[model samples]
Each structure stands twice: as structure tokens, then as C-alpha cells.
Target: MFYTYILASQRNGTLYTGSTDDLAKRVFEHKEKARAGFTAKYGVDKLVWFEAFEERENAFRRERRIKEWRRAWKLRLIEETNTDWRDLYDDLNNLLSY
Candidate 1:
């Protein structure tokens, strides 16, 4: 599986969008500051939102679409599902144990 994900610094701060095949590992790397890029530099490690895709092309396209959206649009998207903008990493971790 592949995933398109959004990370945020805060409710109204910077946002980072990307796609990866290993969503859990990618998010973990970001949380650990393992990669030197936008997420690490901007401190956008909070996994605010994500969607899985069956194909790499679909994930990439969704990520690109999100990247081009306005901040308000992105906020609305997250708010729709995650009004609190909770760190989804913890939720994912719990789900994996089952």
C-alpha cells in the first residue's frame, strides 16, 4: 500500500504533504528528525491527516493535489475528519498491534 499524508506544525502553522509506500516508517522517520528536508526544517512532524491508496500513482497524484491546495482548504480537509488535529502516529501505532 501507498499513502498520501499531511503533517503540520500547529493548527495554523506550516503544512507538509508527501506520499510514501511505508506510511508508518516514513512518519516515524519524520518524528525522529531522521530526514533533512522540509518536515524536519519546519518542525512539521504532527501527522494531521492521511489517506491510503492501492497504487503509487494514485498516492502521488493525491499528494500533488494536496500540495497545490490553499492552506484553508487543507485545514478544512483535516477538520472534517480530525477536528483536534491529533497526532495520528499514536493511533496508527495502536492499530498495528492488533
Candidate 2:
């Protein structure tokens, strides 16, 4: 599956939108600060929102659109699904285990 995901530093903090085919690995890399970049610099490694797609192109397009949105809109999108802004990577792992 392909995915459109949002990572956040903290509640109301820095946010990033990205697309990947391997959601778990990508999020794990972010959490590990695998490379020097925006996510590493700002500690934006919390998986707060995500959507799965069958096609990578679809995920990429959604990610791009999300990135272009206003901060308030993005915050609202996260709050709509993740009111607590919790790290969803753990939950994803659990889901995969089932």
C-alpha cells in the first residue's frame, strides 16, 4: 500500500506531510532521525495522521495537496481524527500484528 502521512513535533508544533509505499519503515526512520533534514531538525517525528492508498501516485498527490494547505486546515485535519495528537505509529504496529 501507499500512504499519505503527517508527522508533527508536538501538539500545535511543526508539521510535515509525506508519501511512502512502506509506511512503517518510513515512520520508523523519522522516529530514529535517520537522516539530517527538516524532520530531524525540528523533531517532527510523531505520526499523527495518515491515509492509505492503493496507488503511489494517489498518495503522492494527496501529500502534495496537504502540504499546500494552511496550517489551520492541517491542524483541523489532525484534530478531526487525532484530537490528542498522539503518536499513531504504535497503533499501526499493533494493527499489523493482528
Candidate 3:
């Protein structure tokens, strides 16, 4: 499986759009600031929204598209499913553990 995910510094804060085959590990890295990049520098480590895809291309495409979207559009997209902008990383890990 692949995933397109959005990470936010906080509710209505800095946001990041990315795609990865391993969603849990990638998000964990962002949270831990494991790499020196936009996510770590901007402190955008809260998993606010995500979508899974059977194909890596699809996930990558969705991530690219979302990255091009306006901030308002991105915020709306996140709010659509995560109105309160809760961190979803823990939930993702729980699901994987099961």
C-alpha cells in the first residue's frame, strides 16, 4: 500500500504534503525530526489527514496535486475529515499493530 498524507504543526498551522509506501515510518520520522528538511525545519509533524492507495503512482500523484493546492483548499480538505486537526500517527500505528 501507498499513502498520501498531510502533516500540520498544529490546527491551522504550517502544513506538509507527502507520499510514502510506509506511512507509519515516514510520519514517525517527521515527528522525530529525523531528517533536515522542510517538515523538520517548519515543525510540521502532526498527521492531520491521509489517504491510502493501492498504487504508488496514485499516492504520489495525489501528493503532488495537494502540494499545488492553495492553503485554504488544503485546510478545507483536512477539515473535511479531521475537523479538529487531531494527530493520526498513533491511530495509524495501532491499526498496523493489529
lDDT of each: 0.90, 0.94, 0.93
lDDT of 1 at 82: 94
Cα lDDT tens digits for candidate 3, 1-98 = 89999999999999999999999999999999999999999999999999989899999999999999999999999999989888988789775553
Q: What does candidate 1's lDDT look like per residue over 17-39, in tens digits?
A: 99999989999999999989988
Worst 10 residues of 2 by lDDT: 89-98
lDDT of 2 by residue, 1-98 (tens): 88999999999999999999999999999999998999999999999999888899999999999989999999999999999999999899775543
TM-score for each predicted model, relative to the true structure: 0.92, 0.94, 0.93
Ten-residue stretch with the least lDDT total in model 3: 89-98
What lDDT score is found at residue 98 in candidate 1? Answer: 43
Report lDDT (Cα) of residue 60, candidate 1: 100
lDDT at 61 for candidate 2? 97
The regions of model 2 sitting more than 4 angstroms off are 96-98
Whole-model lDDT, model 1 = 0.90
* Pairs of residues at least 3 apart in sequence or in different chains that clash in candidate 1: none
